[model samples]
Target: MFTAGHLAANPLPPGIVGALGLGGYQLLADIAGVGAGRLGSQAFLLVAADPDPALPDAGTQISLHQTRLRDESEAAAYVQLAAQLGYLRLSGYRLAPDRHGLRSRINLVNPATGAIAATIPDRAGGRLLRGGPGASQLLVTAGALPPAG
Candidate 1:
């Protein structure tokens, strides 16, 4: 998980950010990435997985690229570009102001199919539930993620 403090402490190189299609955004917690270790391949994959307490050994795993953006409009453009570049699994949250108040939401986009997997309002004490193709349902919460066992 890469938090804002972590980023501030050890900033990522501009090249990495650009390569990941994560420019103009701030990274938050609950982040994970995978590289072709020892496979002699340059492909990298970033993803997040949440286990469902109701079903042991079953949960959803989606490509995770958590970011804090200004609004959905800005995020749409980034997501589109990332998808076009073959970023099949990209997900993040957006925080924007509204007349009622501040609005926050999470979006999971399957860039490969050009479809939105899920969208949930970002709020404290809430859970974002999702299931990948042929995978069990997963539970994601707005609160701090449970310590990995």
Candidate 2:
């Protein structure tokens, strides 16, 4: 998980902002074009209720995801990564389809279906890098796939 600091900086699509009505909610992460599919793809403005410690799985049960777009691709992801002037700016991987994988400080395949690898998270570990009055943070969780029989 990553902290999205530019939620309010970029101009989000009007219809989406209205649909989620996240105006007063606690924004967790704001993803730009991280998802994809046959029809199209989109971005996300993740929000959630206050963190709940009562949940299971290493206090990670409490998470947030708000889909914001469709038809997203490596190119779009690259654009988002490049366009951002924040910590995640240098993440753009040259927009090459052959090497089109999502990356953060930690190296992992982009979870997007059409990403570098269309693999799903099977297991993992995570840590809270930061929690503040402002500035979203990138959290880490460790996981891997099981052995095939």
Candidate 3:
């Protein structure tokens, strides 16, 4: 289970509750390796819960619902996403995990401008960022790594 940090428990909004009742949205996570070169490991953080189906579709809709989601679980998801973004900003990899392997092309975009701030490219192309303590916000999925040499 993913950590919620300091988020407190609260009642969820009607829209989210209804959507959950209807069934939709899924909580997922991608874990990255901590080593360098070919000596690294990776994992995933996936939740059985899903997002509210009635919840908005576009970024604008999600923005609107952000203010409405008071439930601890819903708010936690936002925090987790934000943490993941922060992790990417620092010295970590941003992974999009699948059934067999992790994805390399992951772009952390500004939800507001849709402008690409930090771009993580495929194993053959991009380089990972580096930072100090507190740099790692939340553990992220493993960006596609080059094959073992």
Clash pairs detected, candidate 3: 25-50, 25-51, 30-141, 31-141
Write down the worst ten-residue block by lDDT for model 3.
34-43
Using all chains and alpha carbons, the TM-scores for the candidates as numbered come to 0.24, 0.24, 0.23
Error of 3 at 77 (Å): 27
How do these models rank on TM-score, best leading? 2, 1, 3
Residue 67 miss distance in model 3 (angstroms): 44
Write down the worst ten-residue block by lDDT for model 2.
57-66
Native-to-model Cα distance after best TM-score fit, residue 21 in candidate 2, in Å: 3.6
Q: Write the per-residue lDDT of candidate 2 for residues 27-118, one digit (tens) a residue.
A: 22344322211112222222111223674311111111213322334324323322331222224311111111221111223323323322
Runs of candidate 1 with Cα error greater than 4 angstroms are 1-100, 124-149
Predicted structure 2: lDDT: 0.25
Give candidates' CA RMSD values in order.
17.3, 16.6, 16.2
The local distance difference test score of each candidate is 0.28, 0.25, 0.28
Q: What is the lDDT of residue 52 in candidate 3?
A: 42
